[model samples]
Target: MSGGIGRRALITGAVAGAGTLLSGCDRLGRDERFQRLLRTGEGGNYAVLRLLQDRTALAQEFRPDQRSPVFRMNGVRMPNGDDYARHLATGFADWRIPVEGLVAHPQAYSMAQLRAMPSRTQITRHDCVEGWSAIGKWTDVPLRLLLDRAGVSPQARFVVFHCADPQSNGTMYYESIDRIDAAHPQTILAWALNDELLPPGNGAPLRLRVERQLGYKQAKYVQRIELVSSLAGINGGKGGYWEDVAGYEWYAGL
Candidate 1:
């Protein structure tokens, strides 16, 4: 069977396990949430995978020759807001990603300042909840560097990414991850893709590339990273737009 056929079969099984009786994969094709279960083929995180993953294992990284010819843009393509516009007009020279909330030293980092820091370049496959995948070379500053610089408070348990894009429902797009994923070697604030400055369509200025999670967890247009003790009081209080609105698993480990 072709890779496409096998992947579609996997997707069908993943969705069917959600208790949605499907005559076929057609009508349910549009529902792309809750796909992180594919790690062990169950709708919930498998016990063994979750246990070993606690050791901070790295995701599968690909070689440069394996990079996809084109990486498709998912979710909000361009933010429709005045702030993003102002940043875009200046080529994001004035863009500053603020680190606030439960950190000891709050700081806003500039693009140039970030680029000057020690960076990592990884060629990794981006697994989207949509069941499609793309491999691209991404250059980014390790998220751990920023957290170390800000001195994450002892009470801080989760890192929340605030983005510039607002949904049609009038809420801004944001996502959160635990300190484990935030400290992963592959997890980065990617600013460039395929050796080029990140395109606006692909989250220019900065975006989170938490390699171990599915794509929706990769928040784009990130403007601030707020360290917090809990997710209880944020928008919808579930830690992410999809998690709150669409019932996606908060810890979507791949």
Candidate 2:
């Protein structure tokens, strides 16, 4: 079968599984069956999607004049916690991002230090999983430069971003990227937007800009950077917050 046909079959199977549970008298609800389908098909779906993404052309970028006048911030608008509040109150003077794991050097970089690094500016569109897109300009140090400075180990296959956003159950938000995306030119730790310092509502202090993927891949309010060979033990072992809790695709390649 063609790749497209195969993908369609996989999706159809998953949907059919969901429909069965919805119409049955079984104790398992439709939601449970949907989650089970996602769990069972996640790896294969990711592999197929990744193959297609790798073969496709790079995602389009926007002209500076085409950038949005006001890009609406998606996800947690403001992190709620005493620690985050204290940093905000103090103007983030003591805010630091701890960088460690599978590296020759481990260091805690203050926001000022991160800002001092050489930076890149790009006008790009953020496509959210919920069917919205916004173009904006961003400026930040490339993640590759920071990873290089930290001496990333050869075995490090994934870079995980730990954020400060806390859900009702008190679990922190986190996401991971493989080495290919990690070394991509557009992967940056953004500190500014639209030629101005980042606003608190839009992930002030620092945020990740992973241009090839969707908005959620660009984790906001970043607090820690970890290099890991595998994501088996991080946050329910599904690789990200949404992946663990909402059955969202872990490899959200555009």
lDDT score, candidate 1, position 48: 51
Q: Write the per-residue lDDT of candidate 1 for residues 1-254, one digit (tens) a residue.
A: 35656877888888877645554454454545533333235435634556777556888888899999999998888899888888999989999899999999999999999999999999998899879999999999999999999999999999999998998888999999988788889999999999999988889889999998899999998999999999999989989999899877787764
| lDDT tens readout by residue for model 2, 87-140 | 888888998898899999998999899889898898899989889888999999
Give candidate 2's TM-score. 0.82
Task: Report the Cα RMSD per candidate.
Answer: 9.1, 8.1
What residue pairs are clashing in model 2?
none
The CA lDDT of each predicted structure is 0.87, 0.85
Candidate 1: residue pairs that collide: none
